[model samples]
Target: MKRFAGMLLVAVGVAGCVSNPGVVKTGPSTYMVSRQGKTGFAGIAGLRAKAMGDANTFCAQQGKQAQMTNTSQSSGMPILGNFPRADIEFTCVAMGAE
Candidate 1:
């Protein structure tokens, strides 16, 4: 039973892992960030928040500000292998540039 319990624990831990691919450049000055919530209870809002944070951080690293261009999210049923996910598109622009 102990071995079964250990395996179950490991599975749970892996199930809760969040998948985030940092900012990806899609075009000149434009980037995209995507995040997935693997757990059943993970919500779309949380995934979007994390993606937005990642995009902002990436822009900050370049001494620019992130201006969001588009945002998308999908609600998923984890039991069916679908996981909540969010994607955000943004552009890094000079400070005060709209």
Candidate 2:
């Protein structure tokens, strides 16, 4: 029983550490990134920061800049199994291009 309990704890820890999926191309030059809070204390601000960082990295990789189009976040009740989350929509544009 102790071993089983330990295993379960480990599993839960791993699940909480799960990372956000990478950015997705939604349309021409437009992309989206999303992140879920890892724990009850994790706030939407943290999730949004992570997502924005990812978007910037992705655009940089393409030799472009990230121009945010829209952003949304939900501060769900983590106690009820609804964790905070954030989604960011952006477009990859040239350094000087609108």
Candidate 3:
């Protein structure tokens, strides 16, 4: 029972560390997508991809294509394991009227 409880606690902690990537409107025509994870260069790239993918998906749902304008990353608190993060900014480009 003690072992099971410890495992459960570990799982919960890991779950909390999982990044939930998503998009948010930052301007009338621009949107921002972001994600955070514990990784180095590859992880940062993956997060950037995830952010861009989310932006593309968001624009697609609005009958448009993502026109990525900029990309960024931040090395989060090193004391907290350097949780790297990535963000992408984009505007929705028209794909013709639906």
How well is each residue in 1-98 modelled by candidate 2, as lDDT tens digits? 99989977875776567567889989977899999876667778878888999998998998998989999987546654356789999998888788
Q: What do the candidate models score in CA lDDT, each in turn?
A: 0.82, 0.82, 0.76
lDDT by residue for model 3 (1-98), tens: 99989977765675467675478889899888888774333477887888888888898998899988999888555333356778898999888633
Model 2 lDDT, residue 33, Cα: 95
Candidate 2: clashing pairs of residues:
none
TM-scores of the models, in the order given = 0.76, 0.75, 0.69
Candidate 3 has its poorest 10 consecutive residues by lDDT at 75-84
Off by over 4 Å in 2: 1-19
lDDT of 1 at 26: 96
Q: Evaluate model 2: give its TM-score.
A: 0.75
* Model 2 Cα shift for residue 77 (angstroms): 1.5
Question: Candidate 1 — number of clashing residue pairs?
Answer: 0
Which residue segments of model 1 deviate by more than 4 Å? 1-18
